[model samples]
Target: MKFATTVLLTSAIWTTSALAAPRAGFGVPPKAPGDKNGALAAEQSTSADIEYGYNWAGVIHTTPPATGTYTAASATFTVPEPTATDDSSGGKQGASAWVGIDGGTYRNAILQAGVDFYVEGGTKNYDAWYEWYPAYSNDFNLSISAGDIVIVKVVSSSPSQGVAILENESSGQSATQTLSADPSTATLGGQNVEWMVEDYQSGSSDVALVNFNKVKFTGVQAETSDGQKIGTDGATIYDIQQNGDVLTNVTIISDTEFDVSYEAAQ
Candidate 1:
């Protein structure tokens, strides 16, 4: 029933075709036509090393506005490990989930924490298959060349933090790399880029923007130990937008506690 309640739904009208190249493309390509019922019927392995993608066309201000490709937008859902269940009933108690952006290298692509996206089931045992939207929103307009790959990673806050990757549209030239710790330095497309982090504990969920095009790439850095850091090494940050103006360290209390705001960098 949850999947049925998706805020965003994708509809496909293509003639049935065999599972084409598993390369990343628009929304997890439909399972192979024959995969409807078979041994791989419930193949829920999130580590299939498959491709991910999306299509774009929405209300905006730009005239003849730019149209995003299958790679323009993406998100990663990391389902933290679940606690041991009451074997007697074989049902888990609870789980924690985190999300990250994926598209290009940490440098080439802009990634921000506290963003909202779908959490697809991947390599995790679930009582039911469903998707949840993040209370926050972060957007980025990447300037990738013809062939580029964007990777989205998600982290869980409970049990044990988990990570999954989303491979977005690529020109067969883009690449992605993950780092366990903040990197000493980073350069976007070989050009040094600056990174900054801002923290606010006012329960405000407004997105903080870090313009990628105007990076300086040389500074000490800042963060809030007791709070969330919007930008980390390899991760690009941005300003939060409200009514077309920029706000700082605020949450979108319009509905959820974690609902933040954001937009693609110009």
Candidate 2:
């Protein structure tokens, strides 16, 4: 029951569309990032290759329990006001903070919902979105400002059916979307659950990641089909490593809380 001051909200009707070309989306790891010459690329496949990503950071539940499939995951985070940095993507830098089931070891489709932030020409902007991986993300017309508390959740009714929810605690408004894993041939494996900070794709290239000082995901949790709730107790941590540079740091403060800090992009 805690919040920052000066919270604000804007609203628009929720809409959905299927996009195939030149769309923006959170993608599977293209490869582990390394320096300008692909140093990490030529190195042996260490744990970093499994834990590091060119576009993702945060923690993932790599080892699930032996008995049941995971059904849901959620996280609470404060909206970050991204600032334009020197190595900017031509005023087109941003990041996505999301929670989802699969797409970690599942490697096919991700069921997720959360927020996208961008700093263009010194202006900060945000949008709430939900997606079933390989399909482009559609936006929620929820106007949000820096420091607002947002809670996002993804639930799977079955391997192929699910729902995503995005709630703005400060505004008392929310968006919910029931989803299906149809466009994507991959269904949820229910093996990996994760919370991520991602640098997404725009067309064939990545948008430069701006400096999002610190984004902490609290109330971090997941649940099993048998009704058991889980936390970050046994999770494998991941950070963004691009071209021989580590771009972010993830600190697990507790089972229910963690923080990701931005490092400069080259």
Candidate 3:
């Protein structure tokens, strides 16, 4: 979740990919091709009806009181299978859908987990993973596919420690792992939880964006440090933007549900 601090200020928008360096940790997975030091591109999207960004085409929680300390966050989403696009840059386009805590106003770190839906070489790939910011995400051994119901949760046992769990409800398989917060980095504030789908980026180059028709998140909830459960009703909608355009519109369906409609901005 670490990127250049300039992104936090909407006025100082920059077009280059905002990828951060990977921090050292256990279970560090190998980098994927085009992945720069474990840094994923900032999400960007486009559409006249929605807002935009570099590769992210989803909603974020950005309104006031939306930022607060939290202990845990969870959500269930249907994995999307986006059609691959032939990028003029000689790469395939794709997106990753995930729910996580932090990375909004509290930008220091993020504790999150979710699934990646991508198309490469005309083939679609779906995989589940969990991440503690500044470190490369670790992939789960469980199998995943488009349309599968997946549940992901990240819970903080303490400010610097937590656990991430991912389950494929349809297949009855799951993965759980312990996550230690980086002491050298900012402590996760547990504020600003989010559910989003982002276009994968490699360094400063934009990866092709996959057409993941539509994706929805249900049972979206979080627990505060004081143990109160917060739902989508308590959150403010944030549209992912690139330059000055809106790419997606986030609709609050209910206190526990929300939907992100892709505007398919090129």
Candidate 4:
């Protein structure tokens, strides 16, 4: 499998440099709690609304039909084992699955959390993490493996303060951490919510994407400040693209669920 190095910037307000690297202090991995069942179960939904864009393949809900002080967003999906490719530049190859609030309208900040799957020199690495943009992401100590059912979530009390949670249902391991938005940047709009499978990129270098085949996000739901549970009624879907061509196919399974299939377009 081959992966493209250049990606189209989907957001006009945010530049590639700003979203490229994980900042130094943004993502603080949570301490692993003892293996336990009965973690907070995410709400399950059977329907979802779908729309489509570039560089991102998933669902995005903005304010209009679903508007308010968006407090939290969550999604559950299995970690995919991407097919590794040799990078002529000797870089890693992989992708990330995450759910984040804000970054659609307001460009400067996003409160997000997820897991990463990448290959380096023939070895595949899986790590769970959380990040508040402009700072580097922090990794959790919990063991991660392909096919593990992972549920990730981000919740904000306000625009600047939030907590990220990750749970591996298959392993019974979990991590949680508190974070503040970048102090130097503007506050998060708390307007847009997203569940995405991203081609992991770091510090201006494109990590060779792994062919994860197909990843499906289920049990999707978000909450507004006023306490309204919003579904994917009018959410917009985006496709990750290299140049002007699409690389992934996003299909809405229901009003609150969707699937992303990788095309391995390089």
After superposition, candidate 3 runs with Cα above 4 Å error: 1-68, 86-90, 243-245
Q: List the residue pairs that clash in candidate 2.
A: 34-243, 34-244, 35-243, 35-244
Task: Give all TM-scores, in the order shown.
Answer: 0.18, 0.81, 0.76, 0.80
TM-score head-to-head 1 vs 3, winner: 3
Q: In model 4, where is the ten-residue run with the lowest total lDDT?
A: 32-41
Listing every candidate in turn, what is its Cα RMSD in Å to the true structure after a full C-alpha superposition?
Answer: 20.5, 8.9, 7.3, 10.4
Descending-lDDT candidate ranking: 2, 4, 3, 1
Best by TM-score: 2
Model 3 lDDT per residue over 144-230, tens place: 988899999989887788999999999999899998876556467775777777664544445555667778989888887766787
Instruction: Report the lDDT tens digits of candidate 4 across residue range 40-86.
Output: 11222344433233346687775633446778999899998867654
Better of 2 and 4 by lDDT: 2
* TM-score, cand. 4 vs. native: 0.80
lDDT of candidate 2 over 6-104, digit per residue (tens): 100001101111121222223422333232224332222223222455556787786568878788999999999898888774557788788989765
User: What is candidate 3's CA lDDT for residue 227?
Assistant: 64
Worst 10 residues of 3 by lDDT: 1-10
Worst ten in a row by lDDT for model 2: 1-10
Error of 1 at 20 (Å): 39
Model 2 Cα displacement at 259 (Å)?
A: 0.4
